[model samples]
Target: MSKKFLDDAYNLNSSQETQDLYQDWAASYDDEVAENGYATPRRVAAALWAHLPEPQTPILDYGCGTGLSGLALHETGFRALDGMDPTPKMLEGAQAKGVYRNLKGFDIDDPAPLQNGAYSVIAAIGVIGTGAAPPETFDLLMKALPKSGILAFSFNDHTLDDPAFTSRLTDWVDTGAARILFRESGPHLPRQNLNSDVILLEKA
Candidate 1:
Protein backbone atom coordinates (compact mmCIF):
# COMPACT_ATOMS: atom_id res chain seq x y z
CA MET A 1 0.00 0.00 0.00
CA SER A 2 1.21 3.47 -0.82
CA LYS A 3 1.61 6.19 1.78
CA LYS A 4 -1.26 7.95 0.04
CA PHE A 5 -3.61 5.66 1.96
CA LEU A 6 -2.31 7.19 5.15
CA ASP A 7 -2.58 10.66 3.61
CA ASP A 8 -6.13 10.07 2.46
CA ALA A 9 -7.20 8.65 5.79
CA TYR A 10 -7.63 12.08 7.20
CA ASN A 11 -8.88 14.98 4.95
CA LEU A 12 -12.39 13.56 4.62
CA ASN A 13 -15.15 16.03 3.64
CA SER A 14 -18.42 14.08 3.88
CA SER A 15 -20.07 11.03 5.39
CA GLN A 16 -20.11 9.29 2.02
CA GLU A 17 -16.46 10.04 1.57
CA THR A 18 -15.65 8.53 4.94
CA GLN A 19 -17.76 5.43 4.29
CA ASP A 20 -16.19 4.87 0.89
CA LEU A 21 -12.71 5.45 2.21
CA TYR A 22 -13.06 2.93 5.03
CA GLN A 23 -14.81 0.43 2.81
CA ASP A 24 -11.78 0.36 0.61
CA TRP A 25 -9.37 0.33 3.53
CA ALA A 26 -11.21 -2.17 5.68
CA ALA A 27 -9.45 -5.35 4.52
CA SER A 28 -6.00 -4.09 5.34
CA TYR A 29 -6.85 -1.51 7.95
CA ASP A 30 -5.36 -3.54 10.77
CA ASP A 31 -2.00 -4.22 9.15
CA GLU A 32 -1.72 -0.70 7.77
CA VAL A 33 -2.34 0.96 11.12
CA ALA A 34 -0.21 -1.62 12.89
CA GLU A 35 2.78 -0.49 10.90
CA ASN A 36 2.49 2.84 12.63
CA GLY A 37 2.78 1.00 15.97
CA TYR A 38 -0.69 2.15 16.84
CA ALA A 39 -0.58 2.69 20.58
CA THR A 40 -3.88 4.41 21.25
CA PRO A 41 -5.74 1.11 21.56
CA ARG A 42 -3.61 0.01 24.47
CA ARG A 43 -3.67 3.44 26.02
CA VAL A 44 -7.44 3.76 25.84
CA ALA A 45 -7.93 0.25 27.19
CA ALA A 46 -5.53 0.93 30.03
CA ALA A 47 -7.31 4.14 30.92
CA LEU A 48 -10.62 2.32 31.09
CA TRP A 49 -9.15 -0.57 33.07
CA ALA A 50 -7.64 1.80 35.58
CA HIS A 51 -10.73 3.94 36.07
CA LEU A 52 -13.66 1.62 35.40
CA PRO A 53 -12.23 -1.80 36.44
CA GLU A 54 -15.52 -3.55 36.02
CA PRO A 55 -14.92 -6.30 33.51
CA GLN A 56 -18.64 -6.89 32.98
CA THR A 57 -19.90 -3.36 32.45
CA PRO A 58 -21.17 -2.64 28.96
CA ILE A 59 -18.55 -0.83 26.87
CA LEU A 60 -19.08 0.55 23.41
CA ASP A 61 -16.12 0.78 21.10
CA TYR A 62 -17.13 3.79 19.01
CA GLY A 63 -15.58 4.04 15.58
CA CYS A 64 -14.26 0.60 16.33
CA GLY A 65 -12.89 0.02 12.80
CA THR A 66 -11.89 -3.63 12.36
CA GLY A 67 -12.40 -4.29 16.08
CA LEU A 68 -8.86 -3.39 16.94
CA SER A 69 -9.84 -1.34 19.95
CA GLY A 70 -12.44 -3.90 20.98
CA LEU A 71 -9.85 -6.63 20.74
CA ALA A 72 -7.62 -4.67 23.03
CA LEU A 73 -10.41 -4.32 25.53
CA HIS A 74 -11.10 -8.04 25.37
CA GLU A 75 -7.46 -8.78 25.91
CA THR A 76 -7.62 -6.54 28.93
CA GLY A 77 -10.36 -8.87 30.28
CA PHE A 78 -13.35 -6.76 29.37
CA ARG A 79 -16.13 -9.13 28.33
CA ALA A 80 -19.13 -6.91 27.64
CA LEU A 81 -17.66 -5.21 24.61
CA ASP A 82 -19.83 -3.95 21.72
CA GLY A 83 -18.66 -2.15 18.60
CA MET A 84 -20.18 0.38 16.19
CA ASP A 85 -18.92 1.69 12.89
CA PRO A 86 -20.39 3.17 9.73
CA THR A 87 -18.68 0.88 7.24
CA PRO A 88 -20.03 -2.61 6.89
CA LYS A 89 -16.74 -3.93 5.61
CA MET A 90 -15.00 -2.68 8.70
CA LEU A 91 -17.75 -4.13 10.83
CA GLU A 92 -17.18 -7.47 9.14
CA GLY A 93 -13.57 -7.33 10.07
CA ALA A 94 -14.58 -6.64 13.63
CA GLN A 95 -17.08 -9.48 13.62
CA ALA A 96 -14.37 -11.89 12.58
CA LYS A 97 -12.47 -11.05 15.75
CA GLY A 98 -15.18 -12.59 17.93
CA VAL A 99 -14.39 -10.02 20.53
CA TYR A 100 -17.59 -8.00 20.63
CA ARG A 101 -20.90 -9.34 21.89
CA ASN A 102 -22.61 -7.12 19.33
CA LEU A 103 -21.58 -4.95 16.40
CA LYS A 104 -23.68 -2.27 14.70
CA GLY A 105 -23.16 0.07 11.79
CA PHE A 106 -24.09 3.74 11.91
CA ASP A 107 -22.68 6.99 10.65
CA ILE A 108 -21.26 9.39 13.19
CA ASP A 109 -23.07 12.27 11.46
CA ASP A 110 -26.32 10.65 12.47
CA PRO A 111 -27.64 10.57 16.02
CA ALA A 112 -26.04 8.26 18.54
CA PRO A 113 -26.42 4.74 17.23
CA LEU A 114 -26.88 3.03 20.58
CA GLN A 115 -29.77 3.42 22.99
CA ASN A 116 -29.60 5.68 26.03
CA GLY A 117 -27.79 4.21 29.04
CA ALA A 118 -26.52 1.48 26.75
CA TYR A 119 -22.93 1.67 27.84
CA SER A 120 -21.07 2.69 30.93
CA VAL A 121 -18.03 3.75 28.95
CA ILE A 122 -17.47 4.70 25.30
CA ALA A 123 -13.97 4.03 24.04
CA ALA A 124 -13.23 6.26 21.06
CA ILE A 125 -9.67 5.40 20.28
CA GLY A 126 -8.18 6.74 17.04
CA VAL A 127 -11.64 7.82 15.88
CA ILE A 128 -11.86 11.57 15.59
CA GLY A 129 -9.27 13.87 14.16
CA THR A 130 -7.75 15.02 10.86
CA GLY A 131 -9.85 13.50 8.06
CA ALA A 132 -12.01 11.46 10.40
CA ALA A 133 -14.79 12.17 12.93
CA PRO A 134 -15.49 15.81 13.67
CA PRO A 135 -15.35 17.35 17.12
CA GLU A 136 -19.12 17.81 17.01
CA THR A 137 -19.44 14.04 17.23
CA PHE A 138 -17.94 14.34 20.69
CA ASP A 139 -20.89 16.44 21.81
CA LEU A 140 -23.30 13.88 20.43
CA LEU A 141 -21.62 11.09 22.33
CA MET A 142 -21.66 13.12 25.50
CA LYS A 143 -25.36 13.74 25.04
CA ALA A 144 -26.00 10.05 24.44
CA LEU A 145 -24.67 9.20 27.86
CA PRO A 146 -26.60 8.99 31.11
CA LYS A 147 -25.28 10.71 34.18
CA SER A 148 -21.85 9.43 35.30
CA GLY A 149 -21.11 7.99 31.84
CA ILE A 150 -17.48 7.76 30.94
CA LEU A 151 -16.05 8.87 27.59
CA ALA A 152 -12.51 7.78 26.86
CA PHE A 153 -10.80 9.11 23.74
CA SER A 154 -7.40 9.95 22.32
CA PHE A 155 -6.01 12.67 20.07
CA ASN A 156 -2.85 11.99 18.11
CA ASP A 157 -0.26 14.64 17.44
CA HIS A 158 -1.93 15.48 14.14
CA THR A 159 -5.32 16.06 15.74
CA LEU A 160 -4.14 17.75 18.90
CA ASP A 161 -2.16 20.28 16.88
CA ASP A 162 -5.51 21.76 15.91
CA PRO A 163 -6.24 24.31 18.63
CA ALA A 164 -9.97 23.81 18.20
CA PHE A 165 -9.78 20.24 19.55
CA THR A 166 -7.95 21.50 22.57
CA SER A 167 -10.40 24.36 22.89
CA ARG A 168 -13.45 22.15 22.59
CA LEU A 169 -12.21 19.77 25.28
CA THR A 170 -11.43 22.65 27.57
CA ASP A 171 -14.84 24.18 27.03
CA TRP A 172 -16.54 20.91 27.98
CA VAL A 173 -14.44 20.77 31.12
CA ASP A 174 -15.05 24.40 32.02
CA THR A 175 -18.79 24.26 31.45
CA GLY A 176 -19.20 21.47 34.03
CA ALA A 177 -20.84 19.09 31.61
CA ALA A 178 -17.97 16.69 32.26
CA ARG A 179 -14.99 16.27 34.49
CA ILE A 180 -11.63 14.95 33.42
CA LEU A 181 -10.74 11.75 35.20
CA PHE A 182 -7.37 11.14 33.68
CA ARG A 183 -5.20 12.72 30.98
CA GLU A 184 -1.74 11.76 29.83
CA SER A 185 0.48 12.00 26.77
CA GLY A 186 2.25 8.92 25.52
CA PRO A 187 3.29 6.86 22.50
CA HIS A 188 0.85 6.94 19.58
CA LEU A 189 2.62 5.80 16.40
CA PRO A 190 6.28 5.23 16.83
CA ARG A 191 6.94 5.16 13.09
CA GLN A 192 5.69 8.72 12.76
CA ASN A 193 7.33 9.69 16.04
CA LEU A 194 3.94 10.97 17.07
CA ASN A 195 2.35 11.01 20.51
CA SER A 196 -1.23 11.34 21.76
CA ASP A 197 -3.06 12.30 24.89
CA VAL A 198 -5.51 9.71 26.21
CA ILE A 199 -8.30 11.24 28.27
CA LEU A 200 -11.04 9.79 30.45
CA LEU A 201 -13.93 12.00 31.44
CA GLU A 202 -17.16 11.50 33.37
CA LYS A 203 -20.52 13.10 32.53
CA ALA A 204 -21.81 15.53 35.11
Candidate 2:
Protein backbone atom coordinates (compact mmCIF):
# COMPACT_ATOMS: atom_id res chain seq x y z
CA MET A 1 0.00 0.00 0.00
CA SER A 2 1.15 3.54 -0.65
CA LYS A 3 1.90 5.89 2.22
CA LYS A 4 -1.23 7.79 1.32
CA PHE A 5 -3.36 4.67 1.70
CA LEU A 6 -1.77 3.79 4.99
CA ASP A 7 -2.20 7.34 6.20
CA ASP A 8 -5.79 7.48 5.09
CA ALA A 9 -6.64 4.30 6.97
CA TYR A 10 -6.41 6.23 10.20
CA ASN A 11 -8.51 9.19 9.25
CA LEU A 12 -11.69 8.03 10.96
CA ASN A 13 -13.72 10.58 12.87
CA SER A 14 -14.18 8.39 15.93
CA SER A 15 -13.15 5.11 17.44
CA GLN A 16 -16.65 3.69 17.05
CA GLU A 17 -16.51 4.32 13.34
CA THR A 18 -13.22 2.53 13.11
CA GLN A 19 -14.65 -0.49 14.90
CA ASP A 20 -17.61 -0.56 12.58
CA LEU A 21 -15.35 -0.43 9.58
CA TYR A 22 -13.22 -3.24 10.92
CA GLN A 23 -16.32 -5.31 11.65
CA ASP A 24 -17.37 -4.86 8.07
CA TRP A 25 -13.94 -5.82 6.85
CA ALA A 26 -13.30 -8.71 9.24
CA ALA A 27 -14.05 -11.41 6.66
CA SER A 28 -11.16 -10.31 4.50
CA TYR A 29 -9.03 -8.76 7.25
CA ASP A 30 -6.52 -11.55 7.40
CA ASP A 31 -6.07 -11.64 3.66
CA GLU A 32 -5.66 -7.87 3.58
CA VAL A 33 -3.01 -8.05 6.29
CA ALA A 34 -1.31 -11.00 4.68
CA GLU A 35 -0.57 -8.76 1.72
CA ASN A 36 1.23 -6.32 4.01
CA GLY A 37 3.37 -9.02 5.63
CA TYR A 38 1.64 -8.41 8.98
CA ALA A 39 4.32 -5.93 9.96
CA THR A 40 2.93 -4.02 12.93
CA PRO A 41 1.46 -6.99 14.77
CA ARG A 42 4.50 -9.23 14.36
CA ARG A 43 7.07 -6.58 15.32
CA VAL A 44 5.05 -5.34 18.26
CA ALA A 45 4.57 -8.86 19.62
CA ALA A 46 8.27 -9.65 19.29
CA ALA A 47 9.38 -6.45 20.99
CA LEU A 48 6.90 -7.06 23.80
CA TRP A 49 8.06 -10.60 24.41
CA ALA A 50 11.72 -9.64 24.31
CA HIS A 51 11.39 -7.25 27.28
CA LEU A 52 8.97 -9.21 29.41
CA PRO A 53 10.02 -10.03 32.97
CA GLU A 54 8.33 -13.42 32.73
CA PRO A 55 7.57 -14.94 29.39
CA GLN A 56 4.81 -17.12 30.79
CA THR A 57 2.80 -14.49 32.56
CA PRO A 58 -0.86 -13.93 31.73
CA ILE A 59 -1.46 -11.15 29.22
CA LEU A 60 -4.19 -8.96 27.85
CA ASP A 61 -4.11 -8.33 24.14
CA TYR A 62 -5.77 -5.03 23.34
CA GLY A 63 -7.19 -4.46 19.91
CA CYS A 64 -6.53 -8.12 19.26
CA GLY A 65 -7.54 -8.15 15.63
CA THR A 66 -7.97 -11.65 14.22
CA GLY A 67 -5.76 -12.86 17.10
CA LEU A 68 -2.52 -12.20 15.26
CA SER A 69 -0.81 -10.62 18.26
CA GLY A 70 -2.37 -13.19 20.56
CA LEU A 71 -0.97 -16.01 18.42
CA ALA A 72 2.43 -14.40 18.42
CA LEU A 73 2.38 -14.06 22.20
CA HIS A 74 1.29 -17.67 22.61
CA GLU A 75 4.09 -18.81 20.34
CA THR A 76 6.47 -16.93 22.64
CA GLY A 77 5.27 -18.89 25.70
CA PHE A 78 2.51 -16.70 27.03
CA ARG A 79 -0.11 -19.38 27.54
CA ALA A 80 -2.65 -17.39 29.49
CA LEU A 81 -4.03 -14.81 27.13
CA ASP A 82 -7.24 -12.81 26.96
CA GLY A 83 -8.30 -10.68 24.03
CA MET A 84 -10.29 -7.49 23.74
CA ASP A 85 -11.48 -5.83 20.57
CA PRO A 86 -14.47 -3.72 19.72
CA THR A 87 -15.29 -5.63 16.58
CA PRO A 88 -17.12 -8.88 17.29
CA LYS A 89 -16.38 -10.26 13.83
CA MET A 90 -12.69 -9.84 14.48
CA LEU A 91 -13.13 -11.50 17.86
CA GLU A 92 -14.86 -14.40 16.12
CA GLY A 93 -11.87 -14.90 13.90
CA ALA A 94 -9.65 -14.83 16.97
CA GLN A 95 -11.94 -17.23 18.81
CA ALA A 96 -11.75 -19.78 16.04
CA LYS A 97 -8.07 -20.22 16.90
CA GLY A 98 -8.94 -21.26 20.50
CA VAL A 99 -5.92 -19.35 21.76
CA TYR A 100 -7.60 -16.91 24.07
CA ARG A 101 -9.19 -17.93 27.33
CA ASN A 102 -11.56 -15.04 27.17
CA LEU A 103 -12.37 -12.76 24.22
CA LYS A 104 -14.60 -9.75 24.57
CA GLY A 105 -15.29 -6.36 23.07
CA PHE A 106 -13.44 -3.41 24.58
CA ASP A 107 -13.51 0.31 24.18
CA ILE A 108 -10.12 1.84 24.79
CA ASP A 109 -11.72 5.14 25.67
CA ASP A 110 -13.41 3.55 28.67
CA PRO A 111 -11.18 1.43 30.84
CA ALA A 112 -13.92 0.41 33.26
CA PRO A 113 -14.15 -3.21 32.14
CA LEU A 114 -10.58 -4.03 33.14
CA GLN A 115 -9.63 -4.30 36.75
CA ASN A 116 -6.87 -2.09 38.11
CA GLY A 117 -3.40 -3.60 38.18
CA ALA A 118 -4.77 -6.81 36.70
CA TYR A 119 -2.47 -7.90 33.93
CA SER A 120 1.21 -8.64 34.25
CA VAL A 121 1.61 -7.86 30.59
CA ILE A 122 -0.50 -5.79 28.20
CA ALA A 123 -0.16 -5.35 24.48
CA ALA A 124 -1.71 -2.84 22.09
CA ILE A 125 -0.24 -3.93 18.82
CA GLY A 126 -1.38 -2.33 15.58
CA VAL A 127 -4.08 -0.31 17.37
CA ILE A 128 -2.48 3.06 17.64
CA GLY A 129 -2.16 5.66 14.87
CA THR A 130 -4.88 3.95 12.88
CA GLY A 131 -7.70 5.80 14.60
CA ALA A 132 -8.16 2.49 16.39
CA ALA A 133 -7.91 4.42 19.62
CA PRO A 134 -6.72 7.76 20.91
CA PRO A 135 -3.37 8.34 22.61
CA GLU A 136 -5.13 9.13 25.88
CA THR A 137 -6.19 5.51 25.89
CA PHE A 138 -2.62 4.73 26.83
CA ASP A 139 -3.10 6.36 30.18
CA LEU A 140 -6.17 4.25 30.78
CA LEU A 141 -4.34 1.07 29.82
CA MET A 142 -1.37 1.99 32.02
CA LYS A 143 -3.63 2.38 35.00
CA ALA A 144 -4.68 -1.25 34.52
CA LEU A 145 -1.17 -2.42 35.23
CA PRO A 146 0.49 -2.90 38.57
CA LYS A 147 3.71 -1.12 39.38
CA SER A 148 6.42 -2.53 37.14
CA GLY A 149 3.92 -4.21 34.80
CA ILE A 150 5.04 -4.64 31.21
CA LEU A 151 3.43 -2.98 28.21
CA ALA A 152 4.31 -3.59 24.58
CA PHE A 153 2.90 -1.43 21.83
CA SER A 154 3.69 -0.06 18.37
CA PHE A 155 3.11 3.12 16.41
CA ASN A 156 3.71 4.12 12.83
CA ASP A 157 6.74 6.26 11.94
CA HIS A 158 4.55 9.23 11.16
CA THR A 159 2.79 9.01 14.50
CA LEU A 160 6.10 8.85 16.33
CA ASP A 161 7.15 12.07 14.64
CA ASP A 162 4.02 13.93 15.73
CA PRO A 163 5.21 16.51 18.25
CA ALA A 164 1.99 16.64 20.24
CA PHE A 165 1.63 12.89 20.47
CA THR A 166 5.24 12.25 21.40
CA SER A 167 5.10 15.10 23.89
CA ARG A 168 2.22 13.49 25.70
CA LEU A 169 3.93 10.12 25.75
CA THR A 170 7.16 11.66 27.01
CA ASP A 171 5.30 13.46 29.76
CA TRP A 172 3.93 10.13 31.00
CA VAL A 173 7.41 8.67 31.06
CA ASP A 174 8.79 11.72 32.83
CA THR A 175 6.16 11.51 35.57
CA GLY A 176 6.96 7.87 36.24
CA ALA A 177 3.63 6.73 34.91
CA ALA A 178 5.60 4.29 32.81
CA ARG A 179 9.29 3.70 32.38
CA ILE A 180 10.86 2.96 29.05
CA LEU A 181 12.03 -0.61 28.61
CA PHE A 182 13.08 -0.57 24.97
CA ARG A 183 12.46 1.48 21.84
CA GLU A 184 13.21 -0.04 18.44
CA SER A 185 12.77 1.58 15.03
CA GLY A 186 13.11 -0.42 11.86
CA PRO A 187 11.18 -2.29 9.17
CA HIS A 188 8.01 -3.60 10.84
CA LEU A 189 7.73 -7.07 9.34
CA PRO A 190 8.37 -7.76 5.64
CA ARG A 191 6.28 -5.72 3.22
CA GLN A 192 4.56 -2.94 5.16
CA ASN A 193 5.72 0.57 5.90
CA LEU A 194 9.38 1.50 5.68
CA ASN A 195 10.02 2.03 9.39
CA SER A 196 7.97 1.90 12.56
CA ASP A 197 8.83 1.96 16.25
CA VAL A 198 8.04 -0.73 18.78
CA ILE A 199 8.17 0.54 22.34
CA LEU A 200 8.18 -1.38 25.57
CA LEU A 201 6.89 0.44 28.63
CA GLU A 202 6.93 -0.71 32.24
CA LYS A 203 4.41 0.60 34.68
CA ALA A 204 6.17 2.55 37.37
Candidate 3:
Protein backbone atom coordinates (compact mmCIF):
# COMPACT_ATOMS: atom_id res chain seq x y z
CA MET A 1 0.00 0.00 0.00
CA SER A 2 1.19 3.47 -0.80
CA LYS A 3 1.63 6.07 1.91
CA LYS A 4 -1.27 8.04 0.45
CA PHE A 5 -3.55 5.00 0.67
CA LEU A 6 -2.55 4.35 4.27
CA ASP A 7 -3.02 8.00 5.18
CA ASP A 8 -6.39 8.15 3.48
CA ALA A 9 -7.57 5.11 5.40
CA TYR A 10 -6.76 6.66 8.77
CA ASN A 11 -8.05 10.14 7.98
CA LEU A 12 -11.51 9.16 6.75
CA ASN A 13 -14.30 11.00 8.60
CA SER A 14 -17.54 9.41 7.49
CA SER A 15 -19.06 6.20 6.19
CA GLN A 16 -19.50 7.73 2.77
CA GLU A 17 -15.84 8.55 2.67
CA THR A 18 -14.99 5.01 3.61
CA GLN A 19 -17.33 3.55 1.00
CA ASP A 20 -16.00 5.80 -1.71
CA LEU A 21 -12.46 4.99 -0.79
CA TYR A 22 -13.00 1.28 -1.04
CA GLN A 23 -15.06 1.58 -4.20
CA ASP A 24 -12.11 3.22 -5.88
CA TRP A 25 -9.59 0.77 -4.53
CA ALA A 26 -11.55 -2.46 -4.54
CA ALA A 27 -9.96 -3.84 -7.68
CA SER A 28 -6.38 -3.56 -6.51
CA TYR A 29 -7.12 -3.68 -2.80
CA ASP A 30 -6.26 -7.34 -2.39
CA ASP A 31 -3.10 -7.29 -4.45
CA GLU A 32 -2.06 -3.99 -2.98
CA VAL A 33 -2.26 -5.21 0.55
CA ALA A 34 -0.64 -8.49 -0.38
CA GLU A 35 2.26 -6.68 -2.02
CA ASN A 36 2.63 -4.74 1.20
CA GLY A 37 2.72 -8.04 3.04
CA TYR A 38 -0.53 -7.52 4.92
CA ALA A 39 -0.66 -9.99 7.78
CA THR A 40 -3.44 -8.73 10.00
CA PRO A 41 -6.15 -10.86 8.39
CA ARG A 42 -4.23 -14.07 9.01
CA ARG A 43 -3.36 -12.89 12.50
CA VAL A 44 -6.97 -12.00 13.25
CA ALA A 45 -8.13 -15.43 12.05
CA ALA A 46 -5.51 -17.15 14.15
CA ALA A 47 -6.57 -15.26 17.23
CA LEU A 48 -10.22 -16.14 16.70
CA TRP A 49 -9.30 -19.78 16.18
CA ALA A 50 -7.51 -19.81 19.52
CA HIS A 51 -10.79 -19.19 21.35
CA LEU A 52 -13.32 -20.74 18.95
CA PRO A 53 -11.85 -23.53 16.85
CA GLU A 54 -15.03 -25.28 15.92
CA PRO A 55 -15.54 -25.18 12.15
CA GLN A 56 -19.26 -25.07 12.65
CA THR A 57 -19.14 -22.01 14.87
CA PRO A 58 -21.05 -19.12 13.34
CA ILE A 59 -18.91 -16.03 12.61
CA LEU A 60 -19.63 -12.56 11.39
CA ASP A 61 -16.80 -10.94 9.50
CA TYR A 62 -17.52 -7.31 10.21
CA GLY A 63 -16.00 -4.87 7.74
CA CYS A 64 -14.74 -7.92 5.90
CA GLY A 65 -13.26 -5.78 3.06
CA THR A 66 -13.08 -7.70 -0.21
CA GLY A 67 -13.40 -10.95 1.73
CA LEU A 68 -9.71 -11.34 2.39
CA SER A 69 -10.37 -11.76 6.08
CA GLY A 70 -13.19 -14.18 5.39
CA LEU A 71 -10.93 -16.20 3.13
CA ALA A 72 -8.36 -16.20 5.86
CA LEU A 73 -10.92 -17.54 8.27
CA HIS A 74 -11.90 -20.31 5.85
CA GLU A 75 -8.27 -21.12 5.27
CA THR A 76 -7.85 -21.50 9.01
CA GLY A 77 -10.74 -24.03 9.08
CA PHE A 78 -13.66 -21.75 10.04
CA ARG A 79 -16.29 -21.92 7.27
CA ALA A 80 -19.55 -20.75 8.69
CA LEU A 81 -19.02 -17.05 8.04
CA ASP A 82 -21.31 -14.19 7.09
CA GLY A 83 -19.59 -11.04 5.87
CA MET A 84 -20.71 -7.43 5.87
CA ASP A 85 -18.99 -4.43 4.35
CA PRO A 86 -19.89 -0.85 3.52
CA THR A 87 -18.72 -0.94 -0.07
CA PRO A 88 -20.69 -2.88 -2.63
CA LYS A 89 -17.78 -3.34 -4.97
CA MET A 90 -15.68 -4.68 -2.16
CA LEU A 91 -18.46 -6.97 -1.04
CA GLU A 92 -18.82 -8.15 -4.63
CA GLY A 93 -15.21 -9.12 -4.62
CA ALA A 94 -15.78 -11.06 -1.45
CA GLN A 95 -18.77 -12.82 -2.91
CA ALA A 96 -16.67 -14.20 -5.71
CA LYS A 97 -14.61 -16.07 -3.18
CA GLY A 98 -17.64 -18.22 -2.31
CA VAL A 99 -16.50 -18.66 1.24
CA TYR A 100 -19.13 -16.73 3.18
CA ARG A 101 -22.51 -18.16 4.01
CA ASN A 102 -23.83 -14.65 3.39
CA LEU A 103 -22.35 -11.38 2.14
CA LYS A 104 -24.26 -8.19 2.77
CA GLY A 105 -23.38 -4.72 1.57
CA PHE A 106 -24.20 -2.25 4.31
CA ASP A 107 -22.29 0.24 6.33
CA ILE A 108 -21.86 -0.45 10.01
CA ASP A 109 -23.89 2.69 10.64
CA ASP A 110 -26.87 1.25 8.83
CA PRO A 111 -29.85 0.33 10.95
CA ALA A 112 -29.96 -3.39 10.40
CA PRO A 113 -29.85 -6.31 12.78
CA LEU A 114 -26.81 -8.47 12.09
CA GLN A 115 -27.66 -12.16 12.35
CA ASN A 116 -30.14 -11.00 14.98
CA GLY A 117 -27.24 -11.18 17.45
CA ALA A 118 -26.58 -14.84 16.81
CA TYR A 119 -22.89 -14.87 15.95
CA SER A 120 -20.59 -16.78 18.25
CA VAL A 121 -17.63 -14.81 16.92
CA ILE A 122 -17.26 -11.48 15.06
CA ALA A 123 -13.98 -10.76 13.34
CA ALA A 124 -13.45 -7.05 12.78
CA ILE A 125 -9.95 -7.76 11.53
CA GLY A 126 -8.50 -4.44 10.31
CA VAL A 127 -11.74 -2.57 10.87
CA ILE A 128 -11.60 -0.61 14.12
CA GLY A 129 -9.21 2.14 15.19
CA THR A 130 -8.73 2.98 11.52
CA GLY A 131 -11.06 5.67 10.18
CA ALA A 132 -12.61 3.03 7.91
CA ALA A 133 -15.05 1.94 10.57
CA PRO A 134 -16.30 4.71 12.87
CA PRO A 135 -15.68 4.58 16.60
CA GLU A 136 -19.30 3.55 17.19
CA THR A 137 -18.54 0.37 15.27
CA PHE A 138 -17.45 -1.16 18.57
CA ASP A 139 -20.77 -0.53 20.29
CA LEU A 140 -22.69 -1.78 17.28
CA LEU A 141 -20.69 -5.00 17.21
CA MET A 142 -21.00 -5.54 20.94
CA LYS A 143 -24.73 -5.23 20.61
CA ALA A 144 -24.78 -7.97 17.99
CA LEU A 145 -22.87 -10.36 20.19
CA PRO A 146 -24.58 -12.33 22.94
CA LYS A 147 -22.83 -12.92 26.22
CA SER A 148 -19.58 -14.87 25.73
CA GLY A 149 -19.36 -13.93 22.04
CA ILE A 150 -15.79 -13.23 21.05
CA LEU A 151 -14.43 -10.38 18.89
CA ALA A 152 -11.18 -10.52 16.98
CA PHE A 153 -9.68 -7.31 15.58
CA SER A 154 -6.53 -5.27 15.09
CA PHE A 155 -5.15 -1.73 15.49
CA ASN A 156 -2.26 -0.35 13.51
CA ASP A 157 0.40 1.92 15.02
CA HIS A 158 -1.34 5.14 13.97
CA THR A 159 -4.55 4.09 15.65
CA LEU A 160 -2.68 2.95 18.76
CA ASP A 161 -1.51 6.53 19.23
CA ASP A 162 -5.09 7.69 19.42
CA PRO A 163 -6.18 7.54 23.04
CA ALA A 164 -9.83 7.50 22.00
CA PHE A 165 -9.39 4.04 20.51
CA THR A 166 -7.22 2.64 23.31
CA SER A 167 -9.37 4.27 26.01
CA ARG A 168 -12.53 2.73 24.58
CA LEU A 169 -10.92 -0.70 24.69
CA THR A 170 -10.06 -0.19 28.35
CA ASP A 171 -13.63 0.86 28.98
CA TRP A 172 -14.88 -2.40 27.49
CA VAL A 173 -12.78 -4.32 30.00
CA ASP A 174 -13.55 -1.94 32.89
CA THR A 175 -17.31 -2.16 32.38
CA GLY A 176 -17.18 -5.94 32.85
CA ALA A 177 -18.74 -6.53 29.46
CA ALA A 178 -15.68 -8.22 27.98
CA ARG A 179 -12.31 -9.70 28.84
CA ILE A 180 -9.15 -9.56 26.80
CA LEU A 181 -8.02 -12.94 25.61
CA PHE A 182 -5.09 -11.95 23.41
CA ARG A 183 -3.18 -8.78 22.50
CA GLU A 184 0.25 -8.44 20.98
CA SER A 185 2.03 -6.01 18.67
CA GLY A 186 3.38 -7.58 15.53
CA PRO A 187 4.34 -6.77 11.97
CA HIS A 188 1.58 -5.09 9.97
CA LEU A 189 3.36 -4.59 6.66
CA PRO A 190 7.09 -4.97 6.51
CA ARG A 191 7.26 -2.75 3.45
CA GLN A 192 5.49 0.03 5.28
CA ASN A 193 7.49 -0.58 8.42
CA LEU A 194 4.23 -0.57 10.30
CA ASN A 195 3.09 -2.73 13.20
CA SER A 196 -0.30 -3.48 14.75
CA ASP A 197 -1.69 -5.12 17.84
CA VAL A 198 -4.00 -8.10 17.39
CA ILE A 199 -6.73 -8.39 20.03
CA LEU A 200 -9.24 -11.00 21.09
CA LEU A 201 -12.16 -10.20 23.35
CA GLU A 202 -14.79 -12.43 24.91
CA LYS A 203 -18.04 -10.70 25.86
CA ALA A 204 -19.26 -11.31 29.37
Please report the candidate that would top lDDT against the real structure: 1
Q: How close is candidate 1 to the true structure, as a TM-score?
A: 0.94
Q: Candidate 2 — which pairs collide?
A: none
Q: Count the backbone clashes (under 3 Å) in each candidate.
A: 2, 0, 0
Displacement of the residue 35 alpha carbon in candidate 3, Å: 1.1
- Per-residue alpha-carbon lDDT of candidate 3 for residues 1-204, written as tens digits (9 for 90 to 100): 343355577778877787788888888788888888999889888887876789989888988889999999999999799998878889889999999998887644676647556786889988887676756677778778888888888988888988878777888899998999999899888788989999998889
TM-score of each: 0.94, 0.87, 0.92
Residues 62-163 of candidate 1: C-alpha lDDT, one tens digit per residue: 999999999999988799998999989999999999999988887656765668777768888988787788777777677778899999999888889987
RMSD of each: 1.6, 3.1, 2.1
How should the candidates be ordered by lDDT, best one leading? Answer: 1, 3, 2
Please give the lDDT score for candidate 2. Answer: 0.76
Q: In model 1, which regions exceed 4 Å deviation?
A: 1-4
Pairs that clash in candidate 1: 10-131, 11-131
lDDT of 2 by residue, 106-184 (tens): 6644657678877878898877664567777677678888988877888776677766557756888998787888888
Local distance difference test, per candidate?
Answer: 0.85, 0.76, 0.83
> For model 3, where is the 10-residue window of minimal lDDT?
1-10
